[model samples]
Target chain A: MTHDLTTLVPLPVLIPLCAAGLALALHRHPRAQRTISVVALSLMLAASLGLLVAADGGPLVVDVGGWAAPVGINLVADRLAALMLSVSGVVLLCVLLYSLSEGMTESADGLPTPGGEDPIPVAIYHPTYLVLAAGVANAFLSGDLFNLYVGFEILLAASYVLLTLGGTGARIRAGAVYVVVSLLSSILFFVAIALAYAATGTVNLAQLAQRIPEIDPGVALLLELLLLLAFGIKAAIFPLSAWLPDSYPTAPAPVTAVFAGLLTKVGVYAIIRTQTLLFPDSPGVDRVLMVLALLTMVVGILGAVAQDDLKRLLSFTLVSHIGYMIFGVGLASEAGMAAAVFYVAHHITVQTALFLVTGLVERRAGTTSLDHLGGLARVAPGLAVLFFIPAMNLAGIPPLSGFLGKVGLLESGVRDGGTLAWVLVAGSVVTSLLTLYAVVKAWNKAFWQEVPAGVTRDVRLPRGMVGPTTALVAFGVLLTVVAGPLYGYADRAARTSMDGHTYVDAVFPGGSERGRGESPEAGGGDP
Target chain B: MNPEMVPSGVLVVAIGVLFAAGVYLLLERSLTRVLLGFILVGNGANLLMLVAGGRAGGAPIAGITPVDEMSDPLAQAMVLTSIVITLALTAFVLAMAYRSWQLNGHDEVADDVEDRRIARLAARNAPVYRDVDQGEAGTLDEDAAAARDETERDEAGDKTGEAT
Candidate 1:
């Protein structure tokens, strides 16, 4: 049974998927649907924790349905993969709680219907949310590139439904932009997959890790570029990122928070995987990524500075902070990669927490518009405190996890010792300062300023909403308290990601790099 | 694996043409054309995968193969998966376009006001590096700061009209 723990890798996707079907079937019973979804998610969290602990020893590779690797689907949970699962699981569980507490569970139209006549079918939200989780889980654990692409499609499809849940005009408009942009990128991803297979004859990550280096350098670079462009659009990097600020801010709060936190990070995760496992030998790609990272930081914050709406401002900042992770990825060093991984985990919590708090603010106040918001600090002092902690944490305030992650990244950047790297270091510092400025400005407008005469109504927040947000805030604080061990773990995870042998070995097993160089038939090496 | 078995060059030219048309439509603001572009691109990619699978021949049935020179089933499987994905996305995008048409009377993607604002600001904006002493000479520092804040507030006030 203990040996079978690695088998739990697929359980995260499986449990949620099964729950989604069950929940959808029970749509008339909202309470049962919530119970089913929550129970399934809690189970996933536990399994994710188990996977995290088991994976710490080494990569835990489970060939699904007992099929051999390369040909059959495989789920590999190394430290990096496990950490992503655990972190996202935490965020999802918390966001679900927050939405429930906020009474944001909905009918198909995403609004609470009056009486029992047209019942608000909270059932649909649960199933869609579950499917989204399954998709995220699949992406994190997939060993094959095609499987990863499927994971992305699953998540994006769920997200499309989630984004337009309420069917408001704004949401619909946002959904259109989102769908178009997403489709365009996914098509590119398909083309990239096609081209990669054309070049190498296999789409398994481990096999590609071996074979890609053997191809003509130009072809390899072209393949890597196609993959990057595809993932980059999804990640919301600059030049490819204009649609994000327009798209994310219009979704409902919980949807927006989750999208801000998890969705783009999936893209970042893919970029990290490709940079390390598949294209580690390409320094030029790393440099190109670094420059893009710098541009993303500068451009994103500038947009942030110009925004007056809270959600849009946060959306822009979300784009800005992604630069930090990309900066980490481009370093292509163990330390750089570790810091990047650490920063990713840190950003997910802090950004999601901030967005969740914004939701709370919106509930208390009438809106998240900075101009209309003021005097929240004096009125809803508790909400003000909630908003303050995460805002400061986001700004890289000392002793907070955000600061630690940035320092780790900066330390790595300095150690890399190139003019380009230093330029990124300077851009990162500027971006951090500007991020602090933007969020603090938001704090001053939304919390610190005096409330207007007419705006001093009831500010009481429901216990349910406050409880989950407090939990997330506490979780963010816990990252700081456990900074030593967490950073150590990230450092180790980084080292693991940088080394391709562990991944190659975990998936390939006794079959040495035979997936590459040989024919595609050889990789499938059937019974 | 054999050199002679790569897909016909004609397939490559067709894919290129499909990609070119797809990109041209993708750059348009009309949602219908964008959707069309997306479809074309997806088809192009599927065709690329077909070509990538080498020259097509026999069905990849398990055991008792009709011919050993079977098309690469993996690439076929990938294309099938992508086709399903593309179909699903097309339905979703069609709904979005329909909804957009219902609300706005046309299916054009509305330009983001903020994007336009930022672009305009960037175009007209040059570096403003005002020294503290010279710019506000003979004026109270608090007044200068207040002036700056007022300009910010006015700009923010202008933004308040957007209704989020």
Candidate 2:
């Protein structure tokens, strides 16, 4: 059973990659491209769900090319990884559907008339989207540090293409900042990996977990800080986050939605994995993380409060809420990790749903500028409902997944009882209230105010687009409904991760030397 | 760990200088310079990976060299992968820079529009956006009196004037 599941682990990464090639081949046939993308992603989603169930028993590890763990690239679908993959799988599929519908609507509206802003470059969009999905899955499942870096590069590369699609002046401007910043981060991460390999002679994460603690304390801290720095920029934690809001709001809506939803969380996921599995007892670093989390929350939401554009505001809130997950991680407790996991899952769905709704709003009102949007509640009541559920949920209203995730984090924060943790708790509460105020202000301006002059109200939202967005919103609500089992799984995942041996042992059974094709000179294999 | 496998100081110094110059160029506004900086930094990192592999030695082909005399093949393999990735990304950044040049007649990175708008508003001491709930610019008493709808005025208007 475990071996069968191990085979399933690579499918999430493989299927989309293969499909990407096929989709590119069929690009001339947009119909075939759409079919390939949808079918491929749907299959990947199913594989991810299967992995999620199998991972519940224990992590399923696959040494790629049949090489042993330490010598070859491996993919491990552990509980945390499987959960991330499943959530991302769901998000990727929904966004693909939404973008496809958007493309259809654009062409239907008589787009692609010679020189009229080509309709989303349908030929390139499907392929790049699939590659992005593959990259994200690979990142979630990678067991080797270098493989993880490869995954990051894959996703970042795809994102750069998506962000600057159509090469508009605004997009080019934003992409420049985003690309340069991401390149710098990747270099830093590359340096870190090299240094880590120098220090410990291996980059397999499970092996690193064993060796890292044995290295010089200063060297270990250096490696940890370097990794954190790279991930911090990617995750958009306060001082490193200014580029996100500027860059994200310029992209087309579905592209921005997926970037907003999944990309930063991948970084957060990395931090969680590394902190728990590799450096488990670093109180000092955890405290610093706590401080950073507080600053990220306060500063990010404050930025959100000042935004006039709906996408920009949501982007800022996305940055702020990441702090909540960071806070949960910094607490370094099981409950905290569990809450952080749940929060990540909840935030991904809500943030993407809100962005999708913003896309709908833009379609209806001809802009995402809150200052110009008005009377949406009366003009497009369905869009209003779609927007409101996720908006209020994002603000942490009761009985929603967002509220539950926040409550879980706050409870864990109070349980932590340290001074920094208390401050973070207070900071989180303040951020939540400010978030409420900001979204409410936006709600009033965009949905309730009198319709501004010259704004059209008669544009209808395509059912195809609305269907995916509503399904995603419903999925978010279902998270609240099934909070019991999900939180339980998260708690178990946290416990397993917090005890690093479960992971290490999973990779190297009976303590070592179980995988096939182990090279003799690799030192752990038979001499 | 082998005692004789220490890397040369020259390579270390070279890596340092490359990174320093790369980061310096990276801070420049020109996208071309940024791309150049990225290339420099990428090469510097590749060199660092080389240094991490220990002193250079013969290839690890089975009969060509003894295991002890062979350099760490894994690091070399990783460096090769990183180099390819860097090359691909360099091409991408180059294309983007060209696109920027084409679009704006210069490849200099521009400021965020929203940030600039907010800065302008701050300089002028204006509210970010007008809020209807704030009830226009007025003192509390004046605004409250203006907000009131008097029945007497309504009745008089209905009887004698065009209330509609």
**lDDT, residue A330, candidate 2:** 96
Per-residue alpha-carbon lDDT of candidate 2 for residues A324-439, written as tens digits (9 for 90 to 100): 99999999999999999999999999999999999888888877777678999988889899999999999999989899999999999999898888888899999999999999
TM-score of each candidate? 0.90, 0.92
Native contacts kept (model 2): 0.57
Query: Against the unseen true structure, what C-alpha lDDT does each candidate score?
Result: 0.82, 0.86
DockQ per candidate, 2 decimals: 0.30, 0.24
Q: Candidate 1 — which residues are off by over 4 angstroms?
A: A105-121, A511-527, B116-164
What is the DockQ score, from 0 to 1, of model 2?
Answer: 0.24
- Collision pairs in model 2: none
Query: Which candidate ranks first by TM-score, i.e. highest?
Result: 2
What is the per-residue lDDT of model 1 for residues A323-428, given as tens digits with 9 covering 90 to 100? 9999999999999999999889998998999888888887788667776688888778888888888888888999999999999999999999999999999999
Query: For this target, which candidate reaches the highest DockQ against the unseen true structure?
Result: 1
Superposition TM-score, candidate 2 onto the true structure: 0.92
The best candidate by lDDT is 2
